[model samples]
Target: MASEESLEESKKKVYRKEQALKRTAESLEDDEEIELPRKRYYRQRAHSNPFSDHELIYPAKPEDMKWSMLYGGSNEAPTVADVGCGFGGLLVSLSPALPKERILGIEIRVQVTQYVLDRIHALRKQNQGKEVDYTNIACLRGNAMKFLPNFFGKGQLKKVFFCFPDPHFKLRKHKARIISPTLLSEYAYCLRPGGIVYTITDVKDLHDWMRSHLEAHPLFERLSSEEEESDECVKIMTTATEEGKKVARNGGSKYIACFRRTENPK
Candidate 1:
């Protein structure tokens, strides 16, 4: 038999989900306005196996993607990517920060992606006709590590972010980590020379692992501490992620490592 506490928690979960469905409906149909999605209602497990197969939508190639559909009639392709953009905290923060550049957040989870999509829709509706209408940021459901090249042309992106990614602490799981040699080469293909990759995490081990991999990759060069402090995207990512804020509240350490994609060798 379940305890009263357990029953109460289950009831709350059902109620919260219903509320989410109602809010989603309002955001879809209403012209005037709608409230932002509460993250609690969109909860999911923190870790997803990047290796798993899931039904996902992606373009065969960069040019085949219908950018205008996501950007609301704008033909401009996204120049920034928030890989593994959990709940889209960075995407919302980066939207107005870089208003002219389109930003895309890719997440693997279904419910979490829906929350971000609805959140962006609500924000866009709220700011309709305003000077900064959030037409610059969008969220999509896909595996960033696998399909980045499928969605972005070579040298098309100027920046990519990996914020507090799954640490994958086990030795066997290192391949699942987002910043590996092969993936870095793929990232280099998508980013123009001099483009940046920003990474922040509360886990020291994962941070070091990512740093080492990027340093070893010929196509990447780590930014100096001075250079890191001066970069606006670096600043945004430090506090713009929900995980970053959680780490701060608990007085945990944050490790940030940024790298520049070098120009192709002759």
Candidate 2:
């Protein structure tokens, strides 16, 4: 019973959807080279996220990023990584303020990753080491969930940020959610003793979920409410995530949680 115009519109919509799927498939094909080491390679094959043309950069491997070797120090500079670092907001915004020597912004989207790279390049040119150095900031376009081990060793990172990640709200889709017991282990593994994980979400349920998992994890201890507030990096996280801005514009409340990685129980 639909009108002729409505039927035509539906046909066009179907065509567009098909084309999008085709493009995504092509992007995946283009990014097959960014896989991790042999043991981790098979896992990444199951989930491939691609970046666009401008998003292309020299791929990083764990061996290529040996922290101690790079700095000639037994302990590397306490590093910070922004997972799902869309357009470099968190890394670029907070780099000037952080005391750490290295900040990594990892984004899955090629176009967005490239955008962040351009922004960093521009900022570097203007600042010229006036306020901060670009040598410490780097962007990598790869699947964060899988490639995390590609750049860090056990307990190598000091802080991690998961802001405004895709809130796969459906019950069946919970596994796809960024914060899970399994993923927490990965986060904990990458974090140094006393390192911290910072997460913010507009969805109350997701917020509670992150808090519960992090709190229950034996490797982590919940940060006090006062500690979360007073923490400079936590404050930066509130403004650095894309979703945080969206939440603010809609007059929604943001739920934040922080957990400090602890030594393994003996």
TM-score winner among the candidates? 1
Q: Write the per-residue lDDT of candidate 2 for residues 56-111, one digit (tens) a residue.
A: 33327565654443223453543888888876668867777874557888777654
lDDT of each residue in 21-86, candidate 1, tens digit only: 756677567674567777766778898988898878898999999989889786789999999998
Q: What C-alpha lDDT does candidate 1 achieve relative to the native structure?
A: 0.89
**By lDDT, who's the top model here?**
1
Cα-based lDDT for every prediction: 0.89, 0.70
The TM-score that candidate 2 achieves is: 0.73
CA lDDT of 191 in candidate 1? 97
Query: For model 2, which pairs clash?
Result: 51-110, 52-110
| TM-score, structure 1 vs. true | 0.90
Q: Give the C-alpha miss distance for residue 231 in model 2, angstroms.
A: 0.2
CA lDDT of 133 in candidate 2?
A: 50
Runs with alpha carbons beyond 4 Å of true place in candidate 1: 1-31
- The per-residue C-alpha lDDT of model 1 at residue 130 equals 93
